[model samples]
Target: MDMIVWAGAVLSLAGVAGLVWCILYVMRLRRKALDDATMRSRMQKAVLVNFAALAVSTLGLMMVVIGIFLS
Candidate 1:
């Protein structure tokens, strides 16, 4: 139980870090003066990655909550 809680906490933290990175990456992309096509493609990729990271973070948070309740 304690191990599960620890793992969940670690995963949650990692997910948060990933999300932060995604935000910064998108911000940097927006600031760049890329051509239309390249900018569009990069934006699409960034959106996908950001959504994935958000999902991971959400799941990690849920797991942590569950672990806490269980233990």
Candidate 2:
């Protein structure tokens, strides 16, 4: 249970980092003034990263909850 909690913490931190990255990336993109197609392409990739990061964060939260319950 302790191990599970620690692992969940690590995963949550990783997801937070990813979310920060997505924020920065979008800010940078906004500053770029790119064409519509180009911006859309980049945004598509960011959307995928955002979804995966969200999933990881959610799973990490679930793991923490489960660990607490089991302990």
- Looking at model 1, report the run of 10 residues with the lowest lDDT sum: 1-10
Residues 1-71, candidate 2: write the lDDT tens digits: 98898898888888888898899999999999899999999999999999999989988888888889999
TM per candidate comes to 0.85, 0.97
For model 1, residues 10-62, the per-residue Cα lDDT tens digits are: 87788788788888988999899999999899888877877887777777778
Whole-model lDDT values for every prediction: 0.81, 0.90
Candidate whose lDDT is highest: 2
Off by over 4 Å in 2: none
Clash pairs, candidate 1, are none
Q: What is the lDDT of residue 46 in candidate 1?
A: 78
